[model samples]
Target chain A: MNEILTQSVFFGMFLTLACFEIGLWVKKKAKIAIANPLLVAVILIVAVLTLFHIDYENYKKGADYIQYFLTPATVSLAVPLYRQLSYLKKYPLAIIGGIAAGVLTAMGSIFLLSMAFGLNHEQYVTLLPKSITTAIGMGISDKMGGMAAITVIAISVTGITGTILAEAVCKLFGIREPVAKGLAIGTSAHALGTSKAMEIGEVEGAMSSLSIVVAGIMTVMSVPLFATLIQ
Target chain B: MKFLRQIAIIMGISFLAELLEALIPLPIAASMYGLVLMLLGLVTKLIPLEKVEGAADFLIEIMPLLFVPPTVSVIANLEALKSILVPLLVICISTTILIMAVTGRTAQSLMRIGRSGGEKQESRTVDCGKNKMKNKLATGEEEKTDE
Candidate 1:
């Protein structure tokens, strides 16, 4: 029984699911934005792994399967975008412009800020795609010679912060339009932020969902372009 | 059986994207390919929304659950991250607010221009029925205030 529990594949799967369930329960009870399921799951999994002396490589045997699903999960983002197609068509210029501007600001600010702080090249590059989804962010990080691990951390942090503070930021800015609210959350924080967008309104939900894809595509294109131009 | 078929359709799209990723050698991730192809398929009416909606929704719903492992792997490099943790946190929080404000303001201003151009307001109602109802309720309350 103990051996089965330690087996890499089963261990990884069990820990992942168990941690996520616990995280969900905490979120349900706490009803707080900071009770992010992913953060909780990460903390629990890390603690368990450390206690058991299980290295990440061993844990990855089962976890990689979950990671692999990220591809199809990203593909599935199309459904919401499709559901709101007419909305997109009606205001293509505004939607496109807003996302383009958001993507540029996200990338440009990170680049300039990292430079001001004297972060080394790799750190700056790792942060370049931080606002995009992890699936695409990791890919861009790999291509740009950055650390995928760092990008993941940055992406997670950005997502959590965006999810937690989206409402207050919108209110502070007097951003009453649902479309703007959704785009802002999705652009900066990806799907985690979109989840917050859902709580606001359906218009915000749909717009935020659309922004995830648009911002991702724009960031994917722009990051490499900027990398080469700077070099 | 229906759910299985829906899952297959999504996986099939993902497989195709992987194939393209291998062939093209572009910097883009295969998932992006899948996402774009799925969008095109939906746009062209090649795939009905109902056919894949169930699987797609489930996948999105559990999306955070899937990232648990990758996020945990950060443990391996905590030593390296420790020195920069404070800086990273500050940058992330500040930039989130900056991105939110800029994007929201820009989108809102563009929308104002669009509305002023006399784009049919009624057409917007068809896009999201629920939001329209909520907007009516809020405006109704606002009208009472004016009286």
Candidate 2:
């Protein structure tokens, strides 16, 4: 048993996912907050690694196998997109147009402010794509010569911040409708924030989910343009 | 039928983007380039947003899972991140607040564009869609009064 726990890649993934399933059960019984099982798993794994004095590469020997699912899972996002076809077609211009303005303002403001505030080139580059999903943000950072590690940290913090305060900002600015609230959360913060927004209502969750893809595409389109603008 | 076609187009575009990424040696990762390429195809009507929304939504739904690999990578590269910890922290907080405030306000202003436009009455409805209108217009506004 000890050897199984110690050396088996399957054991590691099973243990992690078992914890995740337990998290699902926990959420069913109680109010699930930022202290989610997956998030806790992150903390737990980190702690276990430190306690055992195990190198991350050693853990990856197990964890990397699970990582293979990321791509197919990502490709799966298309399901919801199909369901919301009527609304998507109805507001084609409005949705895309709104996201365009949102993405440009997001990238442009962060870039200019970071540059003006005395950040070095690398920091400026790292900060450029913070609003984007972490995978893409890290990719942009690498391409533009920013630190990928810093970009990941920045992306996580951004999602966390958005999770914590988006509602406050929504209310502060008077975005009270479910769709608006959802869209704002989804567009600005991506998936993690959408989970929180789902707590608000179904409409918010639906709209928020829709916003993630629109915002993602919009952000991607703007990357090259923004990268050149900053340079 | 329509839904399936859109899914096909999006996946097709994604594959093409992936292929292109391999052909081009950009500093960006090929997956990201695939993403960018996919987005261009969608927005330009080359792929059509309607066609890809299904697959895109499914992918986005599972986004939290996507972070798992990276979070692991985070642990793997924990030592590397430590060297640049302070600046990374600064970038995260400041960038979050700044993006939230600026985008929120900009979106707010765009929502407010009805005051002088010919349809000011409809503009508020557009700005913060009445509950019924919201259901009708998926892109409509919210109660900005929540501010």
Best by DockQ: 1
Pairs with steric clashes in candidate 1: none
* Native contacts matched by each model: 0.72, 0.29
Candidate achieving the largest lDDT: 1
- lDDT (0 to 1) per candidate: 0.80, 0.59
* lDDT, candidate 1, A97-192, per-residue tens: 878888888877887778777777677777888888887888888889888888888888898899888988887766667777888889989877
At residue A163, what lDDT does model 1 achieve? 81
Please tell me what DockQ candidate 2 reaches: 0.26
Measured against the native two-chain assembly using Cα atoms, what DockQ does each of the candidate structures obtain, in the order listed? 0.43, 0.26
Runs off by more than 4 Å, candidate 1:
A1-6, A228-231, B120-147
lDDT of 2: 0.59
